[model samples]
Target: MLLKELSALASPLNDQQIGQLQKTVADLSPQQLAWISGYFWGLSQTPAAAGATPQPLAAAVATAAKPAGKLTIIYASQTGNAKGVAKSLEAAAQADGIEVSLYSADDYKPRDLAKETHLVIVASTNGEGEPPDNAISLHEFLQSKKAPKLDKLQYAVLGLGDSSYEFFCQTGKDFDTFLSKLGAKAITPRIDCDVDYEGDAERWRSDVLGKVKETIGGGASEVVVPLHAATSVGTASAYSKQNPYTAELVANQKITGRDSGKDVRHIEIDLGESGLTYQPGDALGVYYTNSPALADEILAKAGLTGDETVEVAGESLTLRQALIEKFEITASNPQQVAAFAELSGSKKLQKLAEDKDKLRQYANNTQVADVLGEKKTKLTAEQLVGLLRKLTPRLYSIASSQEEVGEEVHLTVGLVEFKNGDNTRVGGASGFLAQRAEESGEVKVFIEHNDNFKLPADDDAPVIMVGPGTGIAPFRAFLQERDARGAEGKNWLFFGDRTFTQDFLYQVEWQKYLKDGVLTEIDLAFSRDQAEKVYVQDKLLAKGQAVWQWLQDGAYLYICGDATRMAKDVHEALITVIEQHGGKSREDAENYLNELRKAKRYQKDVY
Candidate 1:
């Protein structure tokens, strides 16, 4: 009877899952089977399986018989970064003879918190410091009055975010606060990491693992399974953010018109049989060197020889190479300014560092060279090297389909430029691709897989894309993919720019798509053309009834581009559409949007 039930329970299991289960319980004796049964029963006691209740004694017996050491890691990922960190943490924890179970926050029940002994929470903050979609319910539950006391729980959190945002690492901070409020004990202090998070994440993992080992001691045990045995995927990729593949640029063409305000390029690269496979919504990470002009300017300002040798992290290289390829020269941080002020004893640097707002202003306006140029102090090579942060890769949305163009990756990039007083400032990555990188030049690239932002598997499902400015990139890929698959889905695009004549991107292709019947509708919002500035949100409002009808017809809505303002306004507009067209109350409309999010009908690739 037990074996039959086990088989029934495992009916939906995949091949890998079935194999793993068979391997794990292959040598189990009758006693071990009884213990395993109880262990699974305990896990099934939560609200996730509320219909079936586990026997108390059975659960206790199972707990006593099974391995005492285990780690529960929950990740609330907005853009897959937190998921990556959680995966790494689970791997590290399991390597040390600790049983580990990893889960996305959306899949994990809040009630399970009471039973967890060792927990690690990895989360990323979204727009306006709100929790990621996956973490919304869990975050609310922890803050609710009904939250259970978690006095027995010991946990740690790792936060991933960008420093450019005001609420840097806000989600992680919220998690820490919630856990502490519920009486959970801290295993270690939470580590808030910036965009370049690997080094800090590794250190945090080491600390957490150390604490776990200290709490539960054992080098080896009979019940302990090898870490690799429990891995969901096979061997990990060798290339990552730190180490990327240097692929050659095969094609570079201006997708936009000659008179366009935005210089959008359609770039293609040869993967060269690297066996890299990426879905439509994934981003391509490009590693680029700083411009030679910028590097020369920095060297001249600092009064340092480009040929001077500098030792960085045990490797010695020319100062120019270090600045160009290794260190961050353009962007300034508070830490960098503080360090420089202390080193140089400059009153201006020290004064700038005192006020947070003023410091940020200074960092934004001044480059590393500009800061050094203002001061007359001389610095050693080591000091200069220490002042700089490691150069990081930039991620651009992929705009091509493997089905359409196999073994090749395509991107749509908008060159970033701004005037800094008398001098013109350009974005490091965009400028490199636009001006520096030559045709057939080598570009270090890698694919970042995004599981959350994929088109529906069913080709018949309709899609509505809301993208303005450079945000139209992935939508182009979506249309191409749908066209390649010969999908029956209707594609509707709502695009906006300053002017249709000067800023329209992929105009010819869009026309071609319209003629070919690949694109069902195209709505353009040329803001400056009219007396009143119009945007995509305004267009959405204008076509509220039709948009609502499309939603009713099961169309997937995807929004891309600016997260700060546009995404928020579009969201509000969507709510208004639902309210007016669907005849629903404001709260009901809000819930409707939430339901769409839960069902993955409303997806966003906003950044």
Candidate 2:
């Protein structure tokens, strides 16, 4: 009746416009309808009549002539960095009065690409140049023959990865190539950023927003809303990588045996009153300064005095201070080696840098001081500072549930130490937590939430976890949450290390959980306990029948450990188990695992 009355009222809208308006408002709430009614009435009024300063109606007429195009942003992320960048882009675009939509690669439909006028992708490379698990479906669709042509699409891409990897930003390169082949025009050159990507990412965001404003009709600032302003109802704390919270170290106890080759610390940090909350699968990012002795050693190796001043982030500091607080000196990368080789004009170093494989090997095995010592060249203060990348925070998987330990977080940290001739090198963050950080000392920290790795939502669902070494961190959190919630789910853990007695981390806790009926089953594989090496993969194969039965009964599988060898070996072992017990071919088993991943039944948190 209202529609009929509105139609009979001699409205300016034609029949088609009226029909669209009716269709749009059919499902709207009374409050939404009231807001729309006011919006429409305001659009019909002149500036003077709306109680504003008088303005000519010609400006309003011109504003109605152009409608802005929509901007679509998709993120393919493994560890949340790419997603963060995409969210910033969306917020910036909205603040500029542009119509924008954001989607994870998994949630977005491939067919929508043809409808998008402007598209931006922020992708991070996973493993050895592979797309992230959530992005596999979309990545494959774009590469397939059935993908639609996007000739009218204007796009830009930003890639994030570590420069140490041979195939840095390979996933972003793939997306750029795939879209270009489908005839989409690139609005700007693709930017591939290394681990220290904040600066470059901010610049790219500015450039992209500027181009978008120019291409689309601009100046709807009246309707613009800030992202934080709109979402402040249940927003998180302001502490982030840029602005970290200085939390106190509650405890740092050694979990490994004294005779063991490894040094692992069970770290506990107090987050009292900070309102920083996290789930089971989240990671804690820790910022630590390098030791003075190590910084002095680097200065001695570079043939520079500690008194030389160098500039960092527009601030001048002594070379030693910069080394200790601003730059990464413990880990060596291929880019640093190549730069130093060219600066020193060393033929041996130059030849080593020419080969990608050898250069990566050399960088991985050598430290910054060792790399500098390869040549006898004396570099200036600026040159010495230029050879290193900025210090980045280390992320550790949170090992305790907030439900179990209120206002506190826990971590399993393995000390990274190696010998450089007579000198010993230690990882900046690990060494800080294990040795330098005293109980009650402050540590700058933030949480990194990873949705890709999480527990099953169903309380009764069974879970199988494979975590060797420090990979057991998140699983510990998972069990804690499950126990706290009184979940009836069955839990199985496959854990391994060098030796059973020396490296069985949290053995008493596991035993207690088993006795309390919280943990259903546990498997241990100590590689050096016997003559023949036995790992988690061996344990999985040994329990192949039961593993298959658990999968058949709707079990979720998780893997957390070293990505290079352990994760790959466990994956292949699972495939073999499936193929042998499920009566399927090798390809079918692989497809079954892929289906599980798509269904969020298979998850990984590997580094």
Candidate 3:
């Protein structure tokens, strides 16, 4: 009987909680089980009952009544992509006369899942097969023994992931499985999308909307829900990802030392009274053209004339212009290779295409011209346009605060460089911003707002910022904004780079701020300065006590930089510091960190 009871409850408890519960309740009686359940239920119900003191009965009734024919959209986003998709879907759904409610996975309580009728999950998988940070708790709850049955719920999932990963869209798969196990009906099968997810996501949305209409017994006629419309208020005046504003480049200066291997630029673009507004943590999206010389090489190698008219997506333009402003030329995809090899019918190209590994390697190094040069082929302008993907904007972290710089936008760009068979190649956006764009020349740009990364509202709150390399961009803005506001906050910064002499970015400004008493503390870590490798993590451990004291004193911690190594190492270092300084165990320290995250004390702007 006890085993059966345990098994019944196992489905509702998380992996960790279930293990603990099982150990504690192994010898408990059925009466004890009932009593524990009652106790928890009472605890959960207390808040609602407490409201009876002053609330009217009508208020209680209104709360109990659910909105009719409403769509609940939940987004599990790791890097804001899924959140963008979810916002788009909500706009579409609202336009169709369906009421919509949006929630981040972390913000929504698991107990409320049972109240949902129409559910849509927009989820993105993290590195490997991990669920996004926001989705972890809800994901655990859905697979736990305490999960409520959802037999009446109609659901659909849209999973965003990169095909390059081994476990592509694993989080979506998990959600689908858990929903099915809980007896929820699938309104539509889950769709897993790769990097170019816009088309796939649109198709899935249409399918889901159709299912939602049928399930709710609504007619084929489109329903408009005015309340669900996307907000047009406070939109930036400049160009954005969808419709970019062309802003003139006012200045571009090389900031790095000449002897340094890296080339970093301090770029300034004139918003030109566009009334474009951007905060400190926002990123500027730059849409750039491929190098003209490279385009000429491609056209010549392909045996095609640049003047040929090509019709793409109902627009006719010269092949050269299309290649220059519209199509992607730097990166190559597998689909393009397969399509081109089949079109050319070259024996050598066909042989290379036979091996996926070889094809990928060739595609990575060689451009369209190099590939086409290997075989002589006559291609129509339309075919050429079809073979190429659309040009996407690159996001560079904004290095200046609007509060400090006004209309001008500043960026600390590290130009990309690599040797290709004795020839130096640079990334399109970085090179264009650094070398091609002239002073006072127009460059289309926009702002991408990041709400997840923000400064604390309290002026006096202490802040710890750890940023190395290009990751120091936003922190620059933070310090500027704080200084401009005359904030009383004590700011501590841990900045690392190659060498202090050559690579210490914004050195003069930092020194000025230190002298002005705006910056309370500064920790410098130059990895290549010493014989053995030394990073920010090393400095963090050295000052663990002070760091812990700052945290204890209600300091907000911020991390910006390399997502792969730096972020991971810094996180481990934080855990170690917390454990050592707070005299807590490893697990307790992790929970403490998690609490900081939940409280919005720990923030990361990592890429």
Candidate 4:
């Protein structure tokens, strides 16, 4: 009908052009067609089409039909921070009229490294010095003997990590060193960012893009591509850390028995009119305030009154408010401890700071007040505030699928409480959610999408999930989604806790799933129920034959729990299973697991 109307009236295009336009529009949906109309208008406003003097766009197209040099950005992200920065760089580059392309480290072929002219790597280290799961292949290729020398390449690296870890930004450091060894020139010095990395990241982006603009033959342009043109097809809500949705706490029910040592709460939050939606493996980032009592205790230890004025991130506020709402006081890091030791000049702290191992141990076990009370020195507000990092939002895995509960999100939160002398310290976010927050109270939250950790696209593929304690959150969502979709895949769960009756989280729900045939198999490992302590790894070892059989039959494996110990132990257990059952050597077993990871058959969301 549109083509007939165009034929009936006078049009801008000739007969052949009209027919071609019709063919193109025939396959496009309404949204795509509307977007094309706006895009065509944008194209018409270009200088070449407007019969004006040639500008940068026209000149660029006339010269080579593309920009002079290519700026390729590859991001190796574990929990999405590095990916976010890489996307920002891509947008900035496009705005500067530079030819930029972005790819995840998983999708980018390492063999194509020699073809790049300008490159930027945004990576985050996993646990210790390991690269993220998606980056393992690329990282390994660059370090192997097969790597190519790239004397013509110029690049820079931006590393995002936490200072609390021993090997801060190790993956980025590895990439930088690997590229340097292959003769790639550094465009700028590598920047290793701590948790509060926004300011530094912005500066680094400016410097790197300025350098690229000087080298690439494209001037900054007022007419740039629309962000929607480069974005994904679906339109996601604009709720994020910077602009969070004010959600209401629907419920906070304890999931553990009274005799349990752990305090775990099953939380439900109402998304309401926020238009927020999330998948099973995604997390919800919650902004919280510290307990006022803990803030007062820290101020008292520093020998400073709560009324002292302090400046935080260009905002002036009382020291008490800053401690309670802005800075982190519950968890102390080695960097902060070292800095505080220098300020106080306490002989004990100064001696402790000299030993890195002991300093890290003390920082991990102690709190802010423990370090401040080491000396009788009185500190000004500025001096005391400088000892802490900014308070960051906490991320909890989503425990319910949108399929199961509309306009609502669920979480399994364990209250983080520890003893410091006679005082009991609680984590900022957990304390807020478990103790301070009342039913129907407001909480700021946003969805954090995790594409790296998700169920297999094939609904018929079997899945083996090992999630202990609160790690059981995403599995619940996965099971709910599978049940909703009526997936025919076999499901197996290996769960462990301290006691069976006291610590078994969501026991009735798991039993229901089993009885209903949604769950194929279930294994429980109550560490204290037997004479000796048993964990999930022990269960996996005991069922090594069946685990191997399932793997051979094409099963996806998932692990979500403590990265420091549980994940490592489970990983070693799987390697052993492959070694003992497949009659493979230790190295071969490790390589088999690596291949599985590269194939996306094995995934982990360990913290």
lDDT of 1 by residue, 236-334 (tens): 556555457888887777766676666777788888867677778888889989977888887776668889998766888999988898888887777
lDDT of 1: 0.81
Q: Write the per-residue lDDT of candidate 2 for residues 1-607, one digit (tens) a residue.
A: 4875777888866676667666666665443344444444666585666576634333433333334577899999988888888887877776566667889999999988888999999999987788887798999899999899999999999999987877889999999999999999998999999988877987888788788877874444423322222221122887776678999998999999989999999999999878888999889999998888988888887788899988888999999999999999889999999999999898888999999999998888888888888888888888888888999999999999999999999999999987878878888889989888774398999888787898999999999999999999999999999999999989999999999889999999999999999999999999999999999999999999999999999999999989878988999999999999999999999999988988889998888
How well does candidate 2 score on lDDT at residue 291?
A: 86
State the local distance difference test value for candidate 4.
0.86
Error of 4 at 63 (Å): 3.6
What is candidate 2's TM-score against the reference? Answer: 0.88
| Span of 10 residues, lowest total lDDT, candidate 2 | 226-235
lDDT of each: 0.81, 0.86, 0.79, 0.86
By lDDT, highest first, what's the ranking? 2, 4, 1, 3
Off by over 4 Å in 2: 1-68, 220-235
TM-score each candidate.
0.83, 0.88, 0.78, 0.88
RMSD of each: 9.0, 5.9, 14.5, 5.8
* Superior candidate under TM-score, 1 versus 3: 1
